[model samples]
Structures are given as C-alpha cells and as structure tokens.
Target: MTNTTQTGFALDEADRETFRRQGFLTFKVLEEEEMTRAWRTERLALMDRSNAVYTEEWAVSGNTNISNYDRHLDNDFLADLITDRRITDRVASVLGPDVLCWRTEFFPKYPGDEGTDWHQADTFANASGKPQILWPQNSDFGGTLTVWTAFTEATVDNGCLQFIPGSYTSMNYDETKVMEYRPDGINRNRKEGGVRRGFFGYDYRELQIDPDFVPDESQAVPIVLRPGEAVMFWSTLMHASYPHSGKTEDMRLGFAGRYVPTSVHVYPDTDVVEEYGGKVSLDRYGAVVVSGENRYDHNRIATRTTTGHPFRAH
Candidate 1:
C-alpha cells in the first residue's frame, strides 16, 4: 500500500473509527476535474450509438453491459472512484492499507422501477453457500465500506436512499429465509416475527410486517445529492430506496464500491456463483479484492487461498 499522505483525501483517526462502527463512509468532492473529464468523454462515446441502453427506466443510465476490468465493468471512472485516493485512504485508516476493492455495482433507479426492499448489508454479497458476510470478523475490519457516488442529482422525487441510522449493529436477517421473499418465493422459510424482508428474487410484499418495526422516520433523512456529492455507509446498516416520482425524463443514477480485507475466503460453488453472476471472484465464490489505496491493475483477481476461516450458516 502506498503512503496516502500525497492522496489529498486521507482519513483521520476519528473517521476510521466511524467507519469501523458504521460499516460505510463517504467522501464528497474528491474526484479531480481531469478524472471527471475522462469519465464524461468515455460515457459520451458510449452514448453515441443510436441504441444506447440508458433509454430504459430503472437501468444504469448510460452503459448497461460494460467490459469487466472488474464485475460491473470498472470503467475508468468507476475504477478511479473505487480506489480513489480519498476513499482508499479512509479505508486504509480503518482496515489497514493492505486493502482491495472487492466489488463495484452501478445502481440506476429508473423512472418506473420499484425500489428494492428494506434490508441490511451482509446479504448483498454472493460469496457461495455461506452467508454473504462472515459476521464478527466480517463485522470487524470495519465491515464493508460502500462508496455511493452520484452521477446525477438524486432527490426524494428521484428515489433517494433511506436508512435506519443505527441499524447496522442488528444481527442481519437469515439469508435462506430472506430468499423466500424474492418474486419467485423459492427460498422462503419460517421466521419468528414473520417479517420476511425479501431477498434473492423475492418481493417486499411477502414480508410479515414487524408491528414493532417503528423505524425512526425523522432520523431517516432523504439524501438529496448533487451530481458529485455522495455518502458511504456500513454494509450491515438497514437501508432502502424510494421509488422514482420524478418527470419521465428524470432518473436516479449512482455507483457503489464494496471493499473487504484480503484475509477473507471465497466459495467456489457454481450454483452460488450463478446467484451472484455479475461479481468478480478470486476463486469461485471466494472473496474478491477490488480497490485499494494505490496504482494497481484493474480487476486483479487473487489466486484462491484457504487463508481465513470460511463463514457458513445460510
């Protein structure tokens, strides 16, 4: 890991502590003008084609199928944003400089696409048969730092993200049962409270409402970000997005990067691999290292290793 003193966006001790507890953090106005210029140039080239994918609602506005320097196609900008000196330094401050950008995803909420269900962060990783995240240690290493950068203004009308502020510490819901909430209901299981927050392909409607689920709506502020503003949060935090209520021409566009320590193991099961199809794996579903605080090659997958203890319990 390179010394971050020159990276203009180093994180202080307090910032690192916040990330350790919160599971996520964000750095605003860190991208340089030259970087942003290259991003716009490439995107415009992609848009020149008459059949650009952005025409759809709820899809990544510009390019849907980008080449995989990493899964989700680490476009020049995406890669820069993930390993961004600002972001990486902050990550290193908490998880140590020996870090890697594990995953990056572009979440584009179209004008008509329904918002995803309320859920925690661990379930999002597709790391084989075991749960996406291995708790305790998984929760440690500062959990996973998700950098949410806005490509367009994300207002309440355009489906901004909502979260249960202090919910990161809760025991994440069971993945097997959560899968039952998918649209197909393939993995549904009995829940003690009957509040089945959807997963896999499940829909939110199937969830049994937690009558005591009195979410602090007041604390759940709607994040209205400018084209370049962003927020980061812990993976375990309970969060959801609102549906788009903006004009037909408007849609919400943002990008996210998930980072994990290098010591985690990954699962190599094909079936599980299919579940997290778009992800870049170190081995099968083995852990992936995506971004770090230095000039590293893009989409560099580590050779499989049985280093860390496997995290199980689906």
Candidate 2:
C-alpha cells in the first residue's frame, strides 16, 4: 500500500491488482481497544433516535433494519467514522478521487441469530422494488463500494463475513424480481449445508436468475476480523455470513459505509425510502462527500451532521 501526503491510505499498483482479482480487501482501520471502547459507549447513545434524519413515527416504531440505516447522519462519531481517511483514501484509489458516502447501516447478530443469505447488490432494488441508486448509462460499474468495519470480535462461530472471490464481475440475481417479505421466516430457513440464513425478512433466492442455482460453498472464504478492522469490497461481490452459534453471549456488530463516485444519483427520483416493512421520508437525507469534490448536483449533499458537527473530507 502507498501512503502519500495527498492520498492518506491509497493502494499501490500491486494492492489494487489484488483487490480487482479478489473483489475484496481487508485492512486495519482503527485501534482495537479504542474502537471497542467507543462502540460500548456509542451503542447506548445510538438507542435514542430523537434527532435522526428519518424520525417519522413509522421509521422509529420498531427495530427493523430500516431503523438502523444512516445513523451517521445523526451521530457525531458515526459522521466522523464514515469520512475517516483510513477508509476514504483506499476507497478513492479504486473508485476515483471524487466520491460520496450515500449510506451507512449497522448489522448486528446476537447469539442464535441466523446468518445472512448469500447476496449481491447492484441497483439495490431487491428489497425496495425501486432502484435506490442509478449509474450513468455509459459507466462500466453499477454497484457502490462497501466498507464494513467490525465493532466487535468477528469470528466464524460468531457470524463473520464470507465471500466468493472474483464473483463481482457478473450478477447472479435479478434485482427487478420481487421477493415476499415474511418476518416469521427469520432464522427458519436451513439451506443445503444446514446453515441457518435469511435476508432481513425476505428470501434472497426468490430473485435468483436461475431457480436451481446454488452458491459454491466449497469455494467460500470466511473473513475473521478483530475489533476496529475493516474489509472493503464491491457491492456486487457474492457475500454472506455465518450464524452466531450461541457458543458465546457476545453479539457481533458491523458498520457498513457505502461509497460511490459523484456521478451516481442516489435515491433517484424519490424523496422517500420504503423497505424492510417500513417507510421513511427522505426530507433530511443527504450524501456526504468524503473525498474530493462532488461536481454533480443531482444528489443532495450534507455538509454537516444532524448534531451540527462538520464532516471533514480527506
């Protein structure tokens, strides 16, 4: 990796080559002790969503995945976390200098919780039914870059991420296909390998282009991470996680920050986000420019957090 004065953590040619071939890269982003301490304290603060951007009665009504979306827009620590140079610098090296952090979400898996279903996202319409982001017609890429950070120990027995190398070049599921959302289905599906998995409340297999197709688990690699470590990957990469085996009482938490070039239009032609069996107004939604400048005005940009903390670009 190359660390220049201008590019804080930019990847070198060899590093970039590896990322392109594997579709994912793992690196240390923050001090382990500091990250654990911060998460312990911030976890309590995040419970209060009174100042969140999406604070509609329905949005805050339950503990749905939608409720965990975009906390960086409300919390000061999260706001800084999304714009941290350790992340954006490496992201910009692959996605170009001009980038926007359009969304962030917290993924938590408690003991006995089901693992996530194997999935790949391009337009991100698998759940919402409407495309959340749109790339230019001539662009070569369609999906955003995702930086997922572990806020706690991520072990195989406690729900660590799994990936299929080089699976990002082609998509296996059709995003336009509709999937039924059955809340009761959570933790109920036992797949071919007898692994319990589900996608929030929806069945990701319903969107498969080939009904009989199955992911080659033989080639899947588990990503074990220490607290404060992060992995960056293409959103189109085939990825999933193992179930928390109840071997330990500790819950595994991951924070994901999604990034894209300024040319992309986020939440195109929509002012509301409806997914995960809940709907929320996007009146206060704005993408943060983490590095370089956003030359396009197609997306709303947030210069500061909801708590009035300014977002500094790398």
Candidate 3:
C-alpha cells in the first residue's frame, strides 16, 4: 500500500474518527498552478466529446446534470485525478487499502441554474433504476466515497454543495422507487426557502418514504470551495446544493471522483448505462484500482489508460 505520510494525504487516527462520525471530510487537493492546469485541461477536454465514455446529448444544461461520464478512462488528466494520493490515500483509509475508483462525473452550474435537489444514494440506483455498486454481504457499509473537487470556484450564490451532518445512517428515499423523468421539470419547484432545485428533471421528493416529508434546511451546511479544493462524503449522506443566484457571470464547475473497496461490485450485471434520457454502452468501461490489490475478479479492471499508460497510485 502507498504510505499516506509520503503522499501528504493520509488520514491520521483523528482524521479517520472525524470522518466516521461526520460522514464527510474537506481539504485542498491541488496547488494553485496545478489547479490552473486542471482547469485548462478540463476545458479543452469538453471541447471534444469523441473520447468520452458516455456519448449522448443527455444533459439538461451545458454543465451540471449531464451525460459525460468516466473521462478518466480516456483522458490522462482525469486518470491522474482518480489515482492521486491526495484523494486515494484518504479514501483508502476509509474503504481500506484495496480501493477502486469506479466512476467520475462533471457537475457544472451556470448562472440562473437551479440547485441540485436534496438526495442520498446507496447503490446509485436513483436514476438508472439499477444497482450500480453492490457491497459484499459481510460488509456493513453499502455506499461509495464521493470526492467532489472544484474546478472553478463554488459559492452558495453560485450553487455550492450543502450537507446535513451525521445524516448518512438512515435512508429517507428508496432507490427501488422509480421516479418519472421530465425534461421540462427544471426550475419548477420552489422549496420552503424559495430555493429553485430539482434532481435532473425528477423530483427527488417522490422517492421519499414519507410522501409529506421534507428536509430540514436548518441543519444544512454550505460547503463553499475554491478552485482545487475538494470534499469527500458518503454517497448515502443527506446532501444538496444551493441555486446559482446568477449574481456572477462566472459559472461553477465541480468534478466528482467516486471510490469504493475492491470487494464491491460495480455496475453489477449491466452492459449499458441509461440515464438522463440517454443511453451509452459499457464496452469500454473498467474500474481503476487506486490502491492495494484488486482480488475480486467480478469487476472489469482498468490497470492502464486507453493510451496504454499504466495507472500509478502515487
């Protein structure tokens, strides 16, 4: 296993304890120049979607809630981002040494865009109606670790993330309950605080176990991030975002790298991903092992990039 202190991203006993209780942790991932380089790299990557794993005009906006999934397989910058010890080391601390980054996504919010609705995911079956990750039967945890990095600045006024601390234990929404997708549902609902938010055209409220249940905004905390900063949280945590008030012309962009232990099964019994009103084949899909050994053969492992570059977890 890659030593944590050597990479300066390892979690101490205190750090691990904090994460265990809070269900999330925040830190800076890239230096200033590194942040600049990542921004430029992602910008150039978006210009050409030919090499992207998922191909479909499947997004509500030009940024957030889109179909561009898993660029780490084809893009070197993203491949490096997934395996960066600044991320992997800490993730390994929580998920153990044997870890795999199974998914990555880009969330962009333009001025006047609606905030992402409050939600939590266990198997990530909320949108696809299929379990994307299944934990081992012996394990107690069932969620993936999501590391969300800010490519551009994210503020509450510009749609920053919000989380309800210690709310990762019990689930309010059932992924088994299917919600109808409506493209025109954007910016339709005005919650208690006049927050314009929706879950990619579907009302996350529909999956709530209680039809009349509502999230407590009083307990919500804003996670404002500067360029290159990141926050890691359980996928099962109660989380949401703020609406982009459109006070600024600059758009907010967030890149999320999702990690799990090697024993977890990714995209179980699936060949193609259908979501956001678009479909994409899984022929080129492979999980990138970020640390230790991948003893489980159920998942298709991507040890190297499409360009034949071996992935190093340092």
Candidate 4:
C-alpha cells in the first residue's frame, strides 16, 4: 500500500491496491481525537428509542437493535464522516468523478448479541432481475465500495468484521435464496419443507467457505480497528461479523456506506422497488451525495427523513 503523509495523515499505496484487487482495504488507527470526539457527540445526540425504518418483517423493539436507522446525516458531524473528503476522494480515485452514495446502514454487534452469519451481499444484486455487476470481470468498472467505520474500538472480541480476501472475484455461492434469519428485527419463516436460503443466520454451518478450492490461510484476515479507523470493502466481498466476546459493554458500532460508479444499475428488479418505495437512486437509505455525481433526478429529499436516533454522543 502506498503510504504518504498528507494533511497530517497517510494513505499507503499498497492499501489502495488491496482495495482494488481484493475488494477491501482497512485503514487502521487513522482517526484523530477531534474526529472521534465529534462522532461520539453526534452519535450520542442522535440516539432514540424506536424501531420503524425496518420492515415489519424485521422490526423488533429492543435496546440491542435499531430499526430502519437513517437520517442522522443531518447531524453535521455524522454527515461529515459519511462524506469525508479523505474517504470519498479515495473512492473517486477508483470509481471516477461520477459516483454516488448508494446506501448507508449501521451494524451494531453488541455483547451477548449473536453476530450475523457469514454471507455475501449478492442477494441484493439480482433483485432487479437485471444482471448485477460482477467483480474481477468488471474491475475496470468498479461497483459499490462499502466503508465500515468503527464508532467504538472494534476488536475481534467485540465482533469486528471478518472477510475472505479476493473472494469477490468469484460467484461460488448463489445469493438468490431467502434463508431463514431470526436475528434481532429480521425474522422470516419458509413453508414446510420449503428450501430457505439467503445470507442469514441459517446457513452459517452448511455452506463451504470455499468449496472449489483451499484458500491461502494467510489471506483470510480478521480486522480489528480502533474507533475512527475504517475498513473499506466491496459489496460483493465475502464477509461476516462474528459474535461479541469482548469484555466491554459497547457494541461494535459501525456505519457502512456503499459508493458505486453512477453507471451501474441500482435495483435490478421490480419485485423490490414496487414493495419498497425507494427508487434505485444514489440516495438509498437517504444517503446524500456529500460529494461526486449528481445522478439523483427526483427531488424527494424531504421524504427521506429517518425515524429514531440511536447514534448520539454518550
């Protein structure tokens, strides 16, 4: 990775290539005290008791889960981070000047909270029935690059994310099946004897991490980052969050935002968009364009307000 001190921080070249080839890059210990404090303050101010944004299918009232959590971008601090120039500029370097923030969501893996199972995000790919962009093949035309920022120090014990390096290059696993998942607000059941599949808690044990071949053990890396440090991985990368086994009470509070070249198709099928009113725009989950691209044609900003506040300064 290319490492150079810029504006008092550094971005290594090797890390940049890791992001391009492997579909992920982790910048460890990059946040300053000021940035961290600002995020903490804004997050604390944004916390509230509610669970609405999540579909009724995935709504559960509990301190552990924040449903349909979005809209905090209005908070200056949080918005700054989501659209941070250092982050977005790097993304621009890859996807070109024309790009948009397609998605944003928080994955809080708390103590005693069983972690999400190993899965790929490809299910969201074929949703539009159109051909979803594939990596390696489309490396020239980059797709969604998700940045996972840690609100609190993320250690392996507290359920930091795990990833299979370079796995995005293959389509070894079928992502179309809607598997049964009963974690937090997301719960679904299949018909008797009906085959349930999808990236959920159900198939954690059955699927081979790599059925075709043995992977380089050295390449399967687990990332443990400090608060303010972020891990940027592709949407198609094979990744999963492990259970919280750390001694701390704080959850692995992370906010993920997907940035893709404006050229890629958003939602592929009518099945999802018809049920969910959101058009396949860059503002999925109200992800505003902090920078780059102006693909959002419809003026529906007012309707993108998010319910509840689960990310305020403590």
Scored by TM-score, the top model is 2
lDDT of model 2 at position 43: 95
Candidate number with the higher lDDT (1 or 4): 4
Off by over 4 Å in 4: 1-13, 28-32, 48-69, 123-143, 183-219, 268-287, 295-314
TM-score of each: 0.65, 0.95, 0.92, 0.68
After TM-score superposition, what is the CA distance of residue 278 in candidate 3 from its true location, in Å? 1.0
lDDT of 1 by residue, 1-314 (tens): 22346654666666656655655555564444544565467556444323221122213322232212232221334534665666665665656566656556667777755554566545443222244433235343334657677877787777777776667876444444433313333224322222222233454333324534544555665667777666777766777666665466676777776666555432222332223212222332222343343233323353322332111111
Error of 4 at 51 (Å): 14
Worst 10 residues of 3 by lDDT: 305-314
Question: Could you give the candidate ranking by TM-score, starting with the highest?
Answer: 2, 3, 4, 1
Candidate 3 residue-wise lDDT, 111-169, digit = tens: 98898989999999998899999998998878889999998888999999999999999
Q: For candidate 2, what's the RMSD?
A: 2.3
Q: lDDT of all the models against the reference?
A: 0.50, 0.90, 0.83, 0.53
- Residue-level lDDT of model 4, residues 1-314, one tens digit each, is 44335622234566666676778776643455755776667666666324223333323223223243443434445555666766776666666676556556677675755555455555354222233433334544334677888877787788778788887866544544333333433323321112222223354333344555433434556888888788887766767665676478877788777777655544443322311112222232333554455554432222223433222211
Residue 163, model 1: Cα distance from true site in angstroms: 2.1
Candidate 1 Cα outliers beyond 4 Å, as residue runs = 1-8, 14-24, 29-39, 44-74, 123-143, 181-201, 204-214, 267-272, 276-314
lDDT of 2 by residue, 90-121 (tens): 99999999999999999999999999999999
Cand. 1 TM to true fold = 0.65
User: In model 4, what is the error at residue 289, expressed in angstroms?
Assistant: 2.9
